[model samples]
Target: MTGTPNTKIAFKNVRRVFGDGPSAFVALDHLNLDIFDGEFVTVVGPSGCGKSTALNIVAGLLGVSAGECRVDGDIVTGPGPDRGVIFQQYALFPWLTVRENVEFGLKLQGKEKSERRKIADHYIALVGLTDFANALPKMLSGGMKQRCAIARAYAVNPKVLLMDEPFGALDALTRVRMQDQLLETWSKERRTVMFITHDVDEAVYLANRVIVMAARPGRLQEIIDVNLPYPRNDELRLSPQFAEIRNKVWHAVYTRSGQQQPALEE
Candidate 1:
């Protein structure tokens, strides 16, 4: 499950503006980033610092107001099967059973019923949801629902996984478990991953490199290399190396947040 170590996605001088004229708000400004093939990168920033905005741009859900976003050298103009997105909200269809929810994308791809079922079953088992495969979304807990969401996103076998706070909604204990599950899944799948989160510790633990973003015209403030061994576990969380990286990320975030903004001219 080692990454290819080549550039898989790139953002060049990217900017995103919502609305226009007097009501215009620039969510991201001159954002530049490069995500390597099969690499796991986590982005952390203040609430309004465009953490999700950057992720959406890469997912092709939102258009950049300036510059360009490219996946494997191709400009990203729309959502494609090559990318899988998991949001904070589970977004599962209550009417669909767990297996059916995972098969949704494969079905749309015109995959045969038998083949779809095979793929669905494999990912469901991967997420430890085989026992609940026949269960409905309403019957599951918050953590189980998110597991379903992960299985659905991975069932398509996307090359790049875009996760926006996928574990944010779970309780403390469940969040830790989900984090472990995610690492195990990613290790086996070896896909390029970009995760967005507000938790500095989560960012440090999960990412190969952590991108710290500044507020206002959101932009990259710092990128901290994790330099930790793979097959990471909860024990790593208590390691001094983990604490070091976490503190570094926190310092960057704190310094940026405390900086005064320039005055606006009338």
Candidate 2:
């Protein structure tokens, strides 16, 4: 993970606009970025700054209005199993049990019953949800539901993981805990990740690099590298170096957005 990590994802002069003519609202403005393979990059910005929009383009859920977005040097045309997405709301099927939800993607791929169960079980255990595998989505807490979402995303063996504020709905305590859980999962399975979040602290804590975007017609503002030691934990959050980087990102977000105060606390 040194020198150059080989660009797994690249956004070249990309632009995304909604509507047409005078009513058009530009979400992204010629934004360019490169994410290396096995790199964990977190994007943070003010509301409507195209953070999620960028992730969606990488996920192939949305097409760019201009230029191109590529994964592994190929233009992102549409969604593929190689890319997995975890949304803010846990996109689980209520009709399905926990195990079933985890296996949904595998089932879609026409995996045999036993193989689906095996992959689902492995991810369930990885996320520490083995005991709740038989439960329904309604029975799980916010944190637990998110864990299920993570397990489901990882079950398919995606090469890239796209997460859009997956822990935004959780309580402060739970959000911090989920951040650690997600890092642990990523440590074991280092997929190229593009995570979008509004929290500067979360960005600083989890990302190898924090990508800051400007508002209106969103564009890259700055890239802040988090040079902290790996295998990070809650104790790292209390470190002076961590606080410094967090504040740096906070200031960058506010400055880029022209806000007098931070939208969220670190």
Candidate 3:
């Protein structure tokens, strides 16, 4: 009604169980989440907390055993171009040029050679790698390679961007830079994105909303509305507000892990 608007993606009593019959292990338990279009949401929790599994379910790579996951008003069935995933590992083709790798999806769609080239270059430049468009994957830095991977995902123009610790492989400094670059690119592209990361700080820094999940037999623990304005840079990271969100998320994680909740910093 007059409260929150309708969600672009909705998980209705979703339950995901792997294997079959008695052997089935439920990853998500009666989970319900609503993600609005163009929203930047981050899932953070303990390892193997079904965070990635939730992303996979939304991507249609996995199916729910008990409920339905809907995207744009339709139930999810299987992997489709509507979702683009970026994994922790830079899943780039070592053989393909940055441009070729970025445009690979368009090429697969049988777009003409020139068409693919134009599309690829646009995304390459979007990631600030226009000069490296001709370089092979092995030649780029770890951060640059991930940028290409991000560009590759963005090139497809998916309705949702699913990222699983996409910066988990980079060094601390590099990770920060990548976070800034991702925010930069996302601001321009405005695609609905769901990212999974274990870092509470990263989750709070980038997300418009942060979802914290419980451990195995993973279930939603808390949903935090960041409500932080755009152009969030390192300066924002230094604010007391940012620390408050981080501490809140950290406490949630600690509590979920069966440990005492951490105290908030003064």
Candidate 4:
């Protein structure tokens, strides 16, 4: 997708501080970012690094202390349907069927029952979970549950997708599979994605660009491009170019995350 001169998401000198007066804590300092349409940008850092906080701000779930965030040329203030968020916890309605879980947002927006069903079915198919549409969350696997969460996010036709470690709970094999599924969906949908992940390979594989955040106060440390072609699969992971990008992101995370940080083996 082509982008206009205007940025899809802009974070200009943004800062988020907690509390008031002497007891304040700065979560972000002079943070500036510009995410373009169809760009998959991954935010990575160690625990308590405020990485999730950045996603929260962009989602309009949290207010910024300073600076501003704009999505599609409009200044963000409160939560809107333009931005869809998928969190680590699937957050599905346990009582609802997988299809109903995906349709929840549409129902809230006053969509007709039949229309919601169609939309839900489309998304479930998109995530390759068509067979589980009638199943309940309690009956699905962890990865499948996350897929439902992703389907729910997409059913709304959001302008930007914000994911905060959405697959962190899955086992290693499942995490890798989910990552591939996400890449496939994104390649087809091309939605502006701002994702948070601690997995270096996942970030390198899925992101068009990687943004490394420092721990504690959380500030941008570096921005690196991932020129890996779309539809990255296990084969791409074994290639040299992928290894190079992976190394860069790994080192960026390692140091920024305060690890020495190991390099993504090149």
Top model number, TM-score: 2
lDDT of 4 by residue, 1-266 (tens): 21357579988888999999999888888888899978899988766668888899889999988888889878889899999999999999999999999999999999999999999999999999999999999999999999999999999999999999998899889998999999889887779999999888888888889998887677888999888787778899889998888778777777546766544433
> Can you give the lDDT of residue 165 in candidate 1?
96
- lDDT measured at residue 130 in model 1 versus the true structure, 0 to 100: 94
Cα deviation at 89, candidate 2, in Å, is 0.7
Of the candidates shown, which would achieve the greatest lDDT relative to the real structure?
Answer: 2
Q: What's model 2's TM-score?
A: 0.96
List of clashing residue pairs for candidate 4: 254-261
Instruction: Tell me the tens digit of each residue's lDDT in model 3 across 35-153.
Output: 88899999988776799889999988888888888888888999888889999999898998998899899887788998888888888998999999999999999999999999999
Q: Which residues of candidate 4, in runs, are more than 4 Å off? A: 1-6, 256-266
Ranking by TM-score: 2, 1, 4, 3
What's the distance in Å from true for residue 94, model 4? 0.8
| Candidate 2, pairs of clashing residues | none
Off by over 4 Å in 3: 1-6, 20-23, 256-266
Lowest lDDT 10-mer window, candidate 2? 1-10
TM-score, cand. 3: 0.93
Q: Write one digit per residue (lDDT tens) for candidate 1, span 8-59.
A: 9898999999999998999999988888988899998777899999999989
lDDT of 3 at 119: 82
Residue 6's lDDT in candidate 2: 92
> What are the per-residue Cα lDDT tens digits for candidate 2 across 74-133?
899999999999999998999999999999999999999999999999999989999999
